[model samples]
Target: MNLLLAAGVLAVSLLGGARQTEAADCPFDEWRTYKNTELRRTADRKAYFWITSRTAIDADGAPKAYHPDDVGKPCGATGAGLDCPSNAGYPNKSWWPTVLASDPTNPSKAFVQPSGPAKGFFVSKTALQDSANGNERDTARYVDASTIPYLVFPRPFFQLVGTGKPGDLGMAFHLETQKQTAFIVADIGPDEPLGESSIALFKALGGNNPNPRNGSGVASGKVLYLVFPRSVDQRPRKWPMTQEGIEQGAETLLDAIGGMSVLQACATLD
Candidate 1:
């Protein structure tokens, strides 16, 4: 093993020992490092560990609420194309780039709906989907971020963690704060940044803002994400996960890693 992987294995082994669990035999013990983040996996294939700096706000799958008041009326005020940046000084919608697809025909304009019921709605080209609706290929409905608490991944993080697709991974918790919440791997973000979640997720984690453009912010090293690769498959396939269901799913995954005490015992990355 390389130096980084060897160090990760030693760290994980020490952590496991601290919790009195058998030392984890990490098959994919290789550690990927970013700004201040590190991720690893267990030999048992139970989870892909995430030690992230912070979690950002994501509004993609949430209801079509963008304005400060959570209303969509401003989205359709223009009657021609979606009022993408209904607010002035943001015509390009730079803060909200992930939602809009590029207009191949018009290099400057995004491919937002010109006029319709879903005119101002934003859909993730790959990650946004209603899990309860149907198969991702045929009947998958779009996710509503307001209704569901969900986690998001950077494009590269998805491949790095080895989760097959969006909605396959499960669960996230704040280590230092002890804030545990259930989340579907619901959205894919940019290539480098990580820790993006739905408005509801932010609220669950104790945030006041639901606006994607200018929501709340948290400092780095506050949130810790522990993902069970394909753990949603542990339970029966179902759409529209309920709070009770989310909690139960979280409980199950947490139990797999020996409960909160497992990581809580060693929240700091050595």
Candidate 2:
């Protein structure tokens, strides 16, 4: 790991949510190195393990509200001691919720629906480490690389795990589409409401591709395939907030990825 790079992440956090401000520039040396750095600095090392799953209902049974803080919380573990810098600015994680209006006649308060494929909550971890045995994949009790990509990968923007345990305010919900394709995951809290626009994200994911799996059986679940397209042909006029803006914002930000496709296509390359 580069001392200079690690120092840079620490330097950023001093500025009050610096992790969120300058995440785009963090260097990717190795996943372990990245995560180690975050664990060293943040509260939860595995917080970034996230995915797009069915929209979930909060304890109050109300829809979620879209907050960038909630989206950044998973990757925010850098503050807790994980390796990777929180808000490394990778455009990797996807957390979308519906945008509601303030009028009763308008009839859109962003509530979680009763039934649909986008019904449950989305939860996943990028790499599962057997902390007990100090084992990761391919080590008899470690996280297998081949199986990593198969478990619902996060949106192509960020590259941290969004995995949080049950009832940790570690989950997010989508309230827009009922289709199985648009579900994204986030940390859940009891008083929190479900989000509507993020639900749209749960619906926007492209189909899964056949990801290579090592000996481990981590790839057998119903996972979402995060495809970083080649050449972001478009740009965003502004940050996403509204229905159209959210998807458009994601698409625009995703387009800015450099060599994301090449790297993703040959992800196994050392």
TM-score of each: 0.63, 0.23
Strongest candidate by TM-score: 1
Candidate 1, 1-270: lDDT as tens digits: 222233344345444545443334223354567545766665677776666645666655433433223223344323222123443212345644445444556645434444455554432233655555553222125566676787777777667545545655465554333345677777777765667787677666556554555443442235656677776566565455676777677667666666554554444443
- Please identify model 1 stretches exceeding 4 Å from their true place: 1-30, 34-36, 66-128, 131-140, 217-221, 235-238
lDDT of each: 0.53, 0.23
The parts of candidate 2 lying over 4 Å away from their true place are 1-29, 32-240, 266-270
Residue-level lDDT of model 2, residues 16-57, one tens digit each, is: 332232222322222332212221111223222112222221
lDDT of 1: 0.53
lDDT: worst 10-residue window of model 1: 80-89
